[model samples]
Target: MPNCQTESHPPATTTSPPASKAPQTTEALQAEQAPVARDWRAPSQQEIAERKKQLSPDQFKVTQQQGTEAPFRNPLWNNHAPGIYVDIVSGEPLFSSKEKFESGTGWPSFYRPLDPQRIVEKHDDSYGMDRVEVRSKSGDSHLGHLFDDGPAPTGLRYCINSASLRFIPAERLAAEGYASFAYLFPEVKQVLPQSEPTSGR
Candidate 1:
């Protein structure tokens, strides 16, 4: 088994500050607002069946059946492009390149999700191994397992299955309706005009 088969533990509990004390940055506010605007809803059984037919065998297996792909053999394990990864089934934004790191685990690893609310973590005790499984909230797709061994600012690794995600490059975020996330990429932000030109007086 690869590093993806690592043991897991209960997710650490986190506390949020009271609303009055919580300060929201422009980017954080945008990220919180943008996804709701998309109106993502959980698919019905019928829709899931349709998706089963539509997705490739590997995608169906990995996402629907909770199967893991061979390490380093998947498409996105080594991807270094500036982009965000979305749930293949629901198009829900999951991880950003900003939080992604080379974990040498032969899997696409992220230190944190773009929006923590968008993912659901479960305690998985399958294969006689204790693990915390990560899944997309709306799609209910089995993404991969989460582990404690990773680099900071978050010492947790989201060892994801590449087949469960669809990459949206930084340059395409706006065109893909993820413009709010473009701020995560300095290059994208630099090229984006901060304000329109003023008319000559």
Candidate 2:
């Protein structure tokens, strides 16, 4: 037998096969872009944001439980100035300096609100005692209890929880999305001015 050292012959044609196209993805087939993933943490940051979801746990307790903010611990008690106070929970305008009073209670006290309709007074008997409760109309945050010791005019002292308020100064009212309330005080100076005019010129 004769051994033949011969190599196998190659194919006559030496052309590469065409590449197959990639399959279309469901995402590509859809006309619209995919939606973003929802952030579950969103609700946590919205407490003090004033433009999003509900208040955080502590804020809810202080603002909705009629809980007292530690005296001298709140940011607004020492303000000693003029401004509008809104609900910290819902950001609804509630009290203005025009109705604020010095109650000597170490809290922001208001003899009356710009509008009585803004507050919803309810009989609160939670503490084994009958008391008048004050809450914002839109937010329903438990503003401190209302007392009858207020000065003349409304005579209803709304002793509010500082933790339940977001103050906006008279000058910044328009910038803080409260321009419509500008009309509440025709003379802004007369409302939150450093001092009442000695004599109007």
Question: In lDDT terms, which candidate is top?
Answer: 1
TM-score, per-candidate, Cα-based = 0.74, 0.62
RMSD vs true structure, all candidates: 9.7, 32.4
lDDT of 2 at 104: 52
Please identify model 1 stretches exceeding 4 Å from their true place: 1-3, 6-49, 189-201
User: After best superposition, candidate 2 residue 189: deviation in angstroms?
Assistant: 9.2
Tell me the tens digit of each residue's lDDT in model 2 across 1-201: 100011112212212222223332222323422221121112233453453245656567677556666554457755656667887766677777766765555666766665565578788876466677788766667877777655554445677777788888877666566665666556664333244569777
Deviating ranges (above 4 Å) for candidate 2 = 1-57, 184-201
- Cand. 2 TM to true fold: 0.62
lDDT of 1 by residue, 127-197 (tens): 87898899998789999998766665456678999999999888877767777677677576423335577
